[model samples]
Target: MKIEDWFQTLRSKAETIEEKWSDATEQERLQLADQLFYLRQVSDTVVDLWLQFEERLSIAIRRIKQMEGQLPVDDKHTQVAVTNETSDKDSSQSEVASAPLKKGKESTSELKEANPYDPVFRRGEGFYHLRMFQDAKKCFEELMQHAPDWESGRLYYAYSLLFCEEQEHAFREFRLLSRSASSPTVVASSFNAIGCILAEEQQWLEAAQAFKSSLEIKTDQEEARYNLALCYLKDGDAQEALDEIEKCLQKDEDDWESQMLWLRAAQLLQSMDESAELAPPSPIQLPTRDLDTDTLQEMASLYESVGNYHRAQICYHFLTERLPREGWAWHGLAWNTWLIAGTKRALTLMKKAISLAPDQDDFTFSYGWMQLFDGKIDEAVRAFRQMLEKNRENRLGQSGMISAYEKMGEYAAAKRMAKEFTEDQEPYVRSLGYFHLGRLAVVEENWRMAEQYFQRTLPHISQLREVPIYMQLCASKLGEQTSVKELLQPEL
Candidate 1:
């Protein structure tokens, strides 16, 4: 069937479903919900395919037009008539496309002649909107160098840096602009940018304050309000998040992100109400009005270390929500959730962490470990290899590679990696090397060699939980009950 016909059929189906939905019984409604969910997924897939086809079709048409340049005419009289007709049609179409840009450029030229600043700033804005970050950056940098006090140039320069992922430099520039910009709107925007940077660092409280400051300066700054709501959600204040998001929805009901956030906040609030025992304690009075970032981080770390995973989850959730761009926050949350929610859910969170910061060796190493635990040896191997390529000295990456190779039954590669790590300077690396070798020895049923390798590992990493387990197993195989008893002691 034609694409249009298929779409029309889907539309009719949707209309029928909608018509039935209002009159349906509760049981029927439940069944209809499942059908609707599946239908939405199918619709999304079809839309994506259609968009891809449209893009390809447009490119083909452009190529054909280029190839069919200057069509020949049968006679001179016919050529004249055809040329006149075609020229008029083509000129009209060309004029329509170029008119807005041409008029804009004319007005811009007049403004530039009347003003002291160069017209390149406006050109840079056009490039920025076109997503040409490098070109925009160059223009803004040149403008800033020539007119150092120009707030707009500095603001755009910082934005260009931000889009290009020079985050640290962008944060510094934004901070400077926040303090120095004479215009209130520019200062507010600078504050918003600063809040974004703080959020990227997982400083939720500080980010919220930054957004609040921006809102105070520019009351109608919708972006700041939305950001503040996100910060509230991160901080586990569901009611506050709901309230902020509701205000956004009130302003624009069709905003999909705000709608989603509103639902999330409402659900969270409902869950909190349903599980009274799981709710957090009331806030304690502090000497200061607000907690510092360092204090909040320390509390979160302490909770995680003490096995208070629920509390740790709250802290990490706040961090991740406030600083969605920060890979470490996501990784921390994944680890905390893994203790309670199991590997599969944690794996999804870990993947999000990896996507946000692919270059972070630690995040990549953890992702590989999770993949390994999920029995995805090939994927784990690829992740480990990628991490090792970025930082060859990454001990976790090397350890993951050894584990992945062992799981894949590539004993030779695993043994080679074990030998390489055993010779490394770091005690932890050497310990891991010995541990892998001991495991391999056990696999081979060489009890004596396994016991010896485990013994070697013990001196370097006596506190390691797995080391004692392997030591006891090897000793049991070697018919040494005394060593097993000693290794099994609680004090040991």
Candidate 2:
């Protein structure tokens, strides 16, 4: 029986046992008492089972949200690889200029089938949105099996496997996609995926070449542009990175990710310039305690920018103590303090922050994150669950749920929740999920799978720039011999 159904049966047994006690003889009463005790025990057991299932489902749901956030938003570009013959038969032929148009009948047939209100291709999109790769993979695989050569199904299946860290399989699929597609967008997206894979292997030069090829196929694809810039930066070509990012900004100004890349490129260029000049350094200007909170925060950020966690903490501590309810301040302070000290102090401060501003999702998330870091998995789950209840769309809450589930060694629950919360398929979320799965696989001595997960995770390094260097150090313990260089390529 299902867990809930079993629980109901036990509850009914307990009710019957209680009801039978009213008109019993002494011997019958004694018998009824024993029966009642057994029923109570059964009830407790069933209740425990229900709680366990509920907890697992809750954790799974949270992870699903987190994973969904990791998926790319360019759903328009997420197509399955199909033969040219298929394209010729479909209306995508007119949409993609390279495909030779069939006579009027094919176009008419496509138009007749096209229902603006219908979402025929959205069967597993919810799973895809949630970052439930295996579930999404299953859905897409079934779709392809049922409707062979459906481009969207094939693409989504490959995309799901990308999260599963099946690098070779995903890469092969993309290669086939690139070879067969008439659409420049499809070709560009395929090349981009391949470039990202190469980057995971730390083949920076090759990655750059692949990204360039993708851009050649479709110059307007911003992700490819940003990734190519990252490749340039990795190769110590700051000027190229800077120039490329500048051009990218021309196409989309509000792309904060590209802006951050531009910032990194600019910083690298400045470093290169400084190295060339051989000039004496200027004397440092120390700030007094009377400095404004904004200035202090700025100083802290600058220290953080340079990887100076100790100095950053000092600044954050001062700022957060003064502005106790500032959620971001508390978050900054907790992360830096965790690095400088250990998770203990970070936990304390995060708790204080949460108490000071009980409703702030960011502070709640930080507290949960610190708890997870401290190995307080149950506490982390509570904090994340509360955060999610407050706002189902909380990214940090979703990420924290994934972390908590992983810490508790519930891999299936973790994978399920990661997808549910990360609905957008942001690269960072994908990276984080892959990172956890990689670590888990390594622990299980599944080295090949670990290596593939790590490779899939490489494109997300830039998203994790703020993550402690030590986490990477720990993850690098996988027995696989993949180059670290390949895994640091920026995927934006």
Candidate 3:
């Protein structure tokens, strides 16, 4: 075969190896390891072949030199072949030697480049996990210098800065990333970071704008919408807040966090409504009193800030009714009324809330909870079960459904759900499940079993002034008694 053809084959193999290494996953890397070994073998074979050819050419040249001295003249074809042989040897040796040298130099350069920045990235990850934000920032700064367009790295760096309480710098970085001519995901993520930062700073209007930008780019982002709704609430734009939360609920219909945020925002709007009734407007607007909705909204907020849920609810109720289409007033009524009347009345108010804002997951969940509290066991069960169908991980819906099942005397179903729910690290919900089991035993006149459940409640009743009375009753019924006086003894 011609040396030129052999060189072309080597070049093709090198190019294939380069391509494989350029974008290799773990599985691909394992497969390419074998290919790499085969390439090395071929390279070694080519080197040996070239060396042998050079050796033969060198011997022939020496013999030619001796013969030229012995004979008067040489054959033309023979002289030409010797000259060609010498040229080929020189060319082949030069190419072969340069090929290995070039590869070694490239490998060394790549290793040096990687070594300088790899540790910085690794340190950044470690510090981030440990919540050492300031230390993480230094590493990320190094990484940015090495790979400025590294999207994931930049995002982590921005978060580190935010966590370190460097909001201004983080905002600048996020702004840069959002406007960069890069992947759309980077832009969306930057907006998300900006929204979070603005929310933390209580810059509600700017935060809402950032979250809106994020949601427009990626509509399924529940956190962004939830944060946006919170910003609207902060800015005294209850209607807008309600709308954003509903959008979030549409994306993740069972997200309790988003649901809670919406419910709370709705409650604020209701407070605004109630305050409108507390104090009548003067026949003429006061010069000092700003009549903008923002200032008007503050009246209900002031009542709430004073721990007066009654007045707050009253004010929110009035403000919300004026805009009957707005759901926040009804939500406020439900939340405040529930605080006053427990779960039963809360359910009715939540129904009103749902009527005003039919698509809100938060109101729906609260309504189901009210039904559960009202002992509308089957209806509560149905609502929560339906919610779980949309999001299997919905913690509140699952717990509410389980409680409904327990209330319905489906002890086996309730027990199954309780077991699943209790697997969470926070044991309060799981303990409540146990308490419910004990109560079920009591209703069936299983005094001994009731005593067991009542006993379980003892560990969780520090905040309850009446739970011990029930515990005493359970003990008395079971004839394994502790007195109310004994149960109520103050903790040392």
Candidate 4:
């Protein structure tokens, strides 16, 4: 049977088992659970086998193309080899005529081998390891023309380019690799390379952004943190610089660059403090006192906006302690905690926020969304319905209801709620409408309509987890290949 048909039959059997197990004896339920576990393992094994088959097929196709001379050759490398051969044969006319013949032989010999374990690649990598960057660059430049999708070879080529002081070429190569590479380490390293290029050009803000992107992908990159701190110092944001440097020091206390940068930032802050003490207070300055809950709340919002979730969590934590009745403080704390902790803790905080502000549509809607994220679909539906009763125009509540219904397999109800929000002016709300409609189309096996709806939603909600996967599935059903690797890229 086809994979899709087999999946449909398996799903029907699973549903039947679930229905029977719900009313079964304890022993029967235990047997059903064991069967379900075995089915899950079988499903995982099938997916792994499919992925392996796809990889082997891709390799076979590439080899066939290379054998047929369909792959592009490196003309620069070929021309240089030809020119040298012509120079050696200039003394004899007969030899010169045969030079063209010799050139063809040389060209064919110089062509990169189809094997991944080709000796030339190892030689190039050996040269790179020995710090012979120019030689390595030459080898990689030729290798890339033959195997452009070889990620490790491409990354080494970019690194060689950077070491050779070809910053522009290196930056472009790293940027391209970051977009195409699936490994988080490779993507983070690429961003780090781009950051180094920007830093060398004295583009502090851009460099900071690049370093932040790198650290977001792989937070253990101490080098990226040190570079980010240096960029912040260069931009005169001493506090932020100090904070980043302190984080680096925590990871590696003996890191010389981080240690020096921390001292410099500390001195700058101290000097600013001394200068403030010597100068008269500004007319607009507020009276000196302990920070109030309102001040802490504002600071938390600012920190959260800048992706400083740890600091935001601290501020919100203090606010919650100082003003226990403040629902907004609890709400903000939940969001900040959600970034640092997981959904369960965030759900607990959100519940407190909703209880403190029962009339607040935002709190109630957020609670419902949290419930949806935690897989409490029935509870989420009830919360969303309650929110909708309180405020009929709540876009988030409407979207939540549609999502809950869709998750529960209530396609008709999901479609009805989706239609109600389809004309909403908000971009996210309208996007949710198209998203649920696409999901319904998928259930109905209408691949073309699903593709159309997903395309409409992509511009507004491309970041949704299910969007890229479903889009790729639809494309596959239509006999087109589409990469969905970017959807799995890690973020802060």
Q: After superposition, how far is residue 231 of candidate 3 from its true place, in Å?
A: 0.8
Q: What would the per-residue lDDT of candidate 4 be over residues 227-320, giving only the tens digit for each residue?
A: 7887777777878987787787677554433544554555445333322111111221221225555556555654554445776788888888
Q: After TM-score superposition, what is the CA distance of residue 383 in candidate 1 from its true location, in Å?
A: 0.6
Distance from true position, residue 58, model 4, in Å? Answer: 79
Global lDDT of model 2: 0.62
Better of 2 and 3 by lDDT: 2
Q: Report the lDDT tens digits of candidate 3 across residue range 1-492.
A: 997998798788778878888689989888888887888898767655654565466447546765777322432211211011111222111111111000000000011112346456555755655456687789889888987766556766886787676879988988998887255555666787787666666677887788889778867555566667777777778778777767766665544345445545555554444222222112211112223333334545554543456655665566565656778767876777786778755766677778878667677778787777777777777788777888897777877876787677787887677666546666666566566666667667787776776565555554333456667777777676676657654456
- Selected candidate, larger TM-score, 1 vs 3: 1
Per-residue error at 411 for model 3, in Å?
55
lDDT of all predictions:
0.67, 0.62, 0.61, 0.68
State the lDDT of candidate 2 residue by residue for 1-492, as single tens digits.
Answer: 896897688678777777877877899988888887887687556545644565466446535644787323332333222332222223211211111111111000011112221132343544554445677677767766665455555666666677677989989888887788666766777787777777767688987887888889878766677778887877789889877877877775644445545545555554444222221112223334676686677667655654557766877878877887676787788888888888877877777767767877877777777677777888889989998887887777877877777777787877676555334567677677676666666566676666666666655555444222323444566433433343343446
Give candidate 3 regions above 4 Å deviation.
1-116, 274-492
Candidate no. 3 TM-score: 0.34
Q: Please report, as a residue range, the 10-residue window in candidate 4 with the lowest summed lDDT.
A: 97-106
Candidate 3 residue 454 C-alpha distance from true site, Å: 48
What is the alpha-carbon lDDT of model 3 when measured against the actual structure? 0.61
Clash count of each predicted structure: 1, 38, 16, 0
Question: For this target, which candidate reaches the highest TM-score against the unseen true structure?
Answer: 2
Reference-based TM-score, model 2: 0.40
Clash count (model 1, backbone only): 1
